[model samples]
Target: MAKKADKYFKEDKWKIIEEGFNPDYGMVSESIFSLANEYMGVRGYFEEGYSGNKLIGSYFNGIYERSEPDYNHYKGVADFTEYMVNSVDWLYTRIEIDNEQLDLYKSDFEKFYRELDMKTGILTREFVWKTAKGKRIAIKFERCLSMTEVERSTWQASIKALNFNGKIYVTTGLDFSNIHRNSGENMWNCGEKFIQADKNITLGIEGTTINTGLKVSSNCKIQADYESMEEIIEDKLVAVKLCINLEKNKEQKITKIIRNLTLKDESQKEEYEDKKAKIKDGRDDVIVLNEELKEESRKWWENVWKRSDITIDNDIENQQGIRFCIFQMYQTYNGAVKGTNIGAKGLTGEAYNGNAFWDTETYCLPFYLFNDREGAKNLLYFRYKTLDEARKRAEVLDCEGAFYPIATISGKECCNLWQHASLQLQASTAVAYGIWFYEKMYNDKAFIKNYGLEMLIEISRMLATRGDFDKDGKYGYYCVMGPDEFQMMVHNNCYTNYMGRFTLKYTIEKVKEMKEKYPKEYEKVVKKINFKESEMNKWKQIIKNMIIPYSDDTLIFEQHDGFFKLPHVDIDSIPISDFPLYNHWSYDRIYRNDMIKQPDVLMFMLLFNSDFTKEQLKANYEFYEPRCIHESSLSPSVHSILANQLGKEEEAYDFFGFATRMDLDNYNRNTNEGIHTTSIAAAWMNIVYGFGGLRSDGEILSLSPTIPKNWDGYSFKLTYNDEILEVKVNKEEVTIKTLGNKLIEIKVFDKVELINDEGYTYKFT
Candidate 1:
């Protein structure tokens, strides 16, 4: 087996390499090599059977099941409701030779190789297998979830006889018997099952949920000369088997096209018609389907890369890491489905119960805002679609306006923890921030005129009602959880207060703008929400008097009220085994100890960097950084961007590397459960926001490009104000080029430069 470091980079920049097979790491590899196309995803498992620890997960977005919650003293929580559940298990196949099954554990394997090609979105594996009787056969397999057609998955296997060839049988079908579960028990609890078999296909299975009444179906079309058979192994376990014959020293190939469909939002007739059309639409030959779809998939990826690709000339590892992140981000969510937000685990796994988090708005939206404007708008549109639910959530909390969920599937709060779900008011603010962020990025006022303004107003109303007079007799928020979950139930959280204040002030400004420009719309909103002038005055009052805790002696903002008074403990004092305190410590112990889970004040500084001085940024970063454990996957990328701006190059690289390879390295030891979907976007942020040094202040765009202390250079393209600009930085100089024809002025490290209509190359030495 090759060392883990070797997998970071190879000569092929587009491929992720897995050197040798180990049963222990099989599930981890499944996550890192998972393939998805926004609608459906398939885990990267071997076509031939493997008796090992594996989670064979195939998921469809927005399709879910109902499960009863074990409420622990929480009021207003639902008794029995539907949430996102693991849909089905689709990756099932077995190869047999002379009735001797070819399993990984049972057979001797040599010369094994596995890789996931990011550019092509294909996973390939090849190995040589030898049976106990000295019979040898070489097998190669290729798999992909079609990017062009989001509902279909294609799998192909090629086998050749080396020593002896009597009969080679490949049994490929869908098995719902074994699926992924966090605990020992099954989560799906799949109900009624039905199968249909005919000449055009081998087998098809359709099932309905017990409580949700949601129907899921999996059908396989096999293109091979094989005998078809079906068996009901156990009480309800069913599988379809196909047996084939092979000549000596002759090569045989088979392709299995699997189509998965769900009746989540569609009627039964529409579903059947759509399935029938898809069944007859593609070619009968699997090789032709593979080539044709591969070409279309290549073109689709090319269009995105041309506008958003980045190149790190000095480091191949970082280059691969950045592309991997971008590829996965696009694969996970492409803004096709409205009112559907991304889960923390994406379609890759069932961890977090397939619930979305605030990470989508806070960490993931910026990537889409710059590269895919439509995608960014869809994310906000989802929030708008769920506004009523947010409002209901706020009412449940005895507050006004909307209170966004910490983790949710259909916009209802799914998190059971009180501190995380209810008290994290910043989530609602983050949704509002995303609206303002998208408008700022594109300078599009239509968004505000259409949907953004209403969202802001409701969120601001919630913030105003949630705040009260603190110990100092000043208006501020209390008993809130900030970005750092380590410090729970604290008063006057700096990030929450500042963001709340900003939300109030900004919404009031927009309200006035609407009243002046679009009076009818403004009046309609006011009438709908029953807004009174007195409430606006109260918002302004709170915004003016909101207190942000800061220490004058240290020239840095305190994370929250009385944060300095906690029992201060250095992270190094903890043992290595107790590294992640969440698993080892009780909530009471974790709350009082002065250990930071992630940046709190530093995150505030990064968002509103211009609000603070460089000295203050440095002081706050230095004070809070050593205490941080970076347990959350979202932590390192924020620190990386800050370190780059603060001229801490070494620290910047360390944090950047940690985030870019988070899943590949299995740093948190949770990749087996799922990949960190939201953190994947952070990799792009570390480049565009860190090394590229791109920042926007209203209508003015600025860059302060800095090269890491490595080798040659790095460059990336971004869309700003509907114009594309490519920023490249090297050891000695920085250069900016305009890809679109436009006259503009931008600041390069605080110096204004003019870019003419023909485009300009501004070089700073």
Candidate 2:
């Protein structure tokens, strides 16, 4: 039987709440209550230490460790694999009362409650513990990562004696002995340790593998009303001990302020060495207090909500779901640093080895494009910075131009599977699509001319070299895998060919525009890359003849050339135990039938929505929806958006619920690994693009708003042409108003309308 959804979190508009603790749900709760700034993230492991089932995960954004590849005789396989290594436990703590240690699993406790507040980015938990001698004590823990200062975090605990006066001992420090759950090995070597008992501070440095050349320095300051203090130092650990006296009905508070500095550059290594000397001489580092950090993060989130919040009326479940999605989206990335991309797990867990997949461009970019244009540009700029590595990868595959990796971190192919590493073309094409989409949304020709055009041309060249004309004069890719991993090594996968055509066409158009608009700069780029006019002709011819499988009788495109000949399998008939079919069925049994792992044809249609007719969309969605198993987390949101377009209101809402709570409720039963970072972004898309009816594919931005029957009204914000447009949808009509002074024209229900300082409202027919 399939595992039932675990709905442990209570529904609230601004918080994710757990009424009582359950040891069985320990790991799941750890992932659900995780916290992160763009620089680092920590799982919600217990500070006082829990001996139950849990994965203690704390990760830095770009820090990773490399492993030697398994010996394989086959060519074109990766020679090394890199993983985002598990880092320091900045919240490591131990507590003792009346000479009895505290461990959540062994202790007697009651009134256990935990909450993650989305409004303020803080996690709070409180409970009352009974000691061995019957002394009663209440403790509350609060922690938050600083959004304003990316490197700082604060952990605070407030304690009070309920019945009798007692003494409490606390040990807190940074531990570098964290083991990676997947590899079961410690990946860091402790380099330096410093402790100052008089100052109540501790500091340590840890270094990763030599290949990564990365080191992290953690500085911590302790503040508490203590009668005495002591310093302890050990291999890979440095700590401070405090003894505090408590009176009946009086609360005592202890706070720890932590700052982490990473050294990734050779020049910075020298500077860090100099700073280490000063630290041993008792140099005090500046520390921001707990309240100061919390207030700053609150104001940051306040501005973020003003521009990106989605307000829904008469629906509490979706209200909390959508806010959690938006909150995680911003927490994962906000363009604070360059040369960094959102990983599959987004620093939440150690799944997918922290490598970024095609989902970054296909699922995550739209949310950032509409909200933080700079962040969107930074995502594309990562591709530009890694262009050389892409070219080297293409040379290894014997292709003409750049072929981006299917899974990557630090611009290298990291997937050990040969089939996926070599045959998938979506990553290269997705990069091209991202560049085109960014320029279309922002109208930033300067970005296109400087960085985007080079990547586009190279991607187009790879597409041209990778595909060829079939025996019947039709151009298509063979021996490839589409988005649906079920049917691999297929001919002319529809989505691949369609996106390939779009990439080539866009590249040619931009090259011509550059030549006409900025002739001098275009010449410079052309000379730098050694461009030729004949390659342009090849791209144009390929676009003109690219074959996309279609049929007139069914009015739907075949998923691939020979997909119709395969035997059909009724997806609903499969046993629930066999769900996540990859785990249950034989490897070859999955690809023998017509069951799809995810959306294939429907995906390209969604990306280029304006290119397809309504009848085409309805016909394809009807044929494909029944066959999709939604094994991938990226599947349901695509289905939801297309179902909305086809006016299948109930079906769309059902899929929307699945996409929004895929992690919150552990619908997939694998959220213990980490949060599904891309799916979280997709939930935002489900609201703005799915129900609010916003479409940016056409020349003018448009909306065809529809409200779910359960909701009385809904509203969201979109940034277009440097202006903020607030769209409100009710049962009777739709209202759109801009926050800026510029006049804008958009299509509302297939009719053109103009809005300025005032706004435009459209009534239902």
Candidate 3:
């Protein structure tokens, strides 16, 4: 890897080389990786730097966001940005000795190593850093993104004394000044210190009706301590803390135990000594029991590896590339719905504060459904819990049915861009598809009869309300947009039209099943939804006649009617910096270009896989891949899967790499905000579904193996149709391992199912 100066810009150019570490930087020197049932990920950093950039980060699900605004609020209930969390930024604190900022680039340091034991989820950072005056110190810090009490955050630091030095002081800083931007853009300039660090580790921060206030009036349990010192800076001695004597470090460790800060509301303080004594009670017992917190983290990861590990070809660079992508995503996942997943900015920087993209439905969902059914259900439940608020959103516009947000942190609409928000309502259809995805994988019938069926009913009702009928009785979801931010105020978009029809079909089926199985429940649900039987008839008519303007002869699915009539400009040779054209061009201009933010035709094809034939998949893949600008970090992964299905091997791998590297290498160059947590699950899907050739037919497991020329072998485990099946692939054939020794019938594509022994294998196509 290329070396950097005082500034640490990850030179992701070379992939095979190992990078060194620097620890003077507290959390700075730490490398982290995180996983939840939702997703897995990691991160690396130089620990000794005081001046190297602030920190490195990674995150995974249910990584939250209130990303952008839904501008067309004048129409439906919500847009986006409403359902998000100003998530706690785990990356923190730089100690400035005297006037010199604590920077690895600015100081002399040694003995730095950041090790991530993949077997366990323990990340340990160790190093010694010296001040400009030659005061040396040794330190070790450990951290883990929780896998146990899902959604909780935890970390611990252990500092050691190295030498007899001067008076030492340390001040934990919690900056909470950024969270207000009303520029019709979600500019995450405000830090919004949400963690409570008052007396103990308690803080509250949010961009509410105020200037992005952080009211840290609450906490779980935390303790901290520090002493102040007078240090000379710029030829003047001032009382401040950021440095201390080796003697003081030793004294605190020996003589009197260091005081622990108790947390509380801004008005409260912790009773440290008393609590410390209480905390120490079982310490001896814990020491004897041999706590395996670190070991358990490893074991958990070992299980993940057994299920999800991938082996790339000798191109260690690409191997590193894929790992790096997974790393960033794993960290940012705040397991609670109270927290929205991070955006592409992945806590490395604050970009979109609270925006949920279609990535959640189309990209991130598959990964979660396959491995952690409950986690995926939690995400669905999140939307369900917000159903009331979603309804309120519709009422605000005098509309019926719950209209979910486009981008949000509070499960409320936040995005104010009309085209952006209305275009995303289409995601609700995908959300329905996600419900179906869960059912196919887990067969959790009770879950569906209760939450799933109801959710589908409401969403279908929402789509019905959102649509219009032409004189010929064909349904037209008019004046709306598709994933392509271009083409505003257009007629029925093929993707949108198909999605609506799909929603109607699924909702009716679910309602019908409920009616037969639980007549009372179905009647109660229908009554509660205020759904008229006439509405069902309307939906059927719409599904039967909805216009999808695709040209088979031209081999193209028009994004919407009159789409080709608009000016067409391909991004054949655009500069990297120019890739984010929204900064320069007007939204109108952007809409006019052939550029698309994410998959539209590909999305339809992926969701309704059985609807499109092999030739259709090939045709759409070829037509849309070139035209796709992939502005959304959520795009590449879906494209990769479709490409894989269509036998476009090279495009699949390249797009997969692009998706995986989106935030880690900061390929989008926007990691300054928070990472794109939800979007990255797409990268995982690209590996499992695209490379491993994993798919579903709602009733059976399907596999079509096509290893990248660069991969040695790749394998992934899935709980398919309630059967835990392992799919392994080399250069040609694919193998599956399952329990019970049943002859499993699998499909090469969605069309053919092959019966293989307990361990199934199929040659590459």
For each candidate, the alpha-carbon lDDT, in order, equals: 0.76, 0.87, 0.56
Any runs in candidate 1 off by more than 4 Å, and if so which? 1-11, 70-72, 76-83, 183-199, 227-239, 266-288, 470-473, 756-765
Clashing pairs in 1: none
lDDT of 3: 0.56
Candidate 2 residue 408 Cα shift, in angstroms, is: 1.4
Pick by TM-score: which candidate is best?
2
Stretches of candidate 2 exceeding 4 Å from the true structure: 1-4, 199-202, 267-287
Model 3 C-alpha RMSD to native: 7.3
Which candidate wins on lDDT?
2
lDDT of 3 by residue, 1-765 (tens): 011113332333222121455333233223223233223232344322245554333333333333334344455534444322232233333455455555566666678655555445555566676776766666665555445433233445445556545544443322222222223333223222223223333332222222232222111233335553332211111112234444535533211111112221233334323333333332212211113444555566666656555556565544555555544444444243322443434443334543555566666666667665655777677677667877776666455777776665456666676566655566577678778777766767777866787778778778877888888777777887787765678788888888788778878888778889888777777777776767788778778888888787976778787766766676666665565777867656877666666777787787767667788788777777777787776777788888887777887777776565554455554544445666667777778777776667545666766778876776666765555677677776776777445555667655555443456556655
Per-residue lDDT tens digits of candidate 1, residues 480-542? 899999988899899999999888888988898888998888888888888776788889889
**Candidate 2 TM-score, true structure as reference:** 0.97
- The candidates, ranked best first by TM-score, are 2, 1, 3
RMSD of each: 3.4, 1.9, 7.3
Lowest summed lDDT across 10 adjacent residues in model 1 is found at 1-10
Q: Rank the candidates by lDDT, best first.
A: 2, 1, 3
What TM-score would candidate 3 get against the native? Answer: 0.77
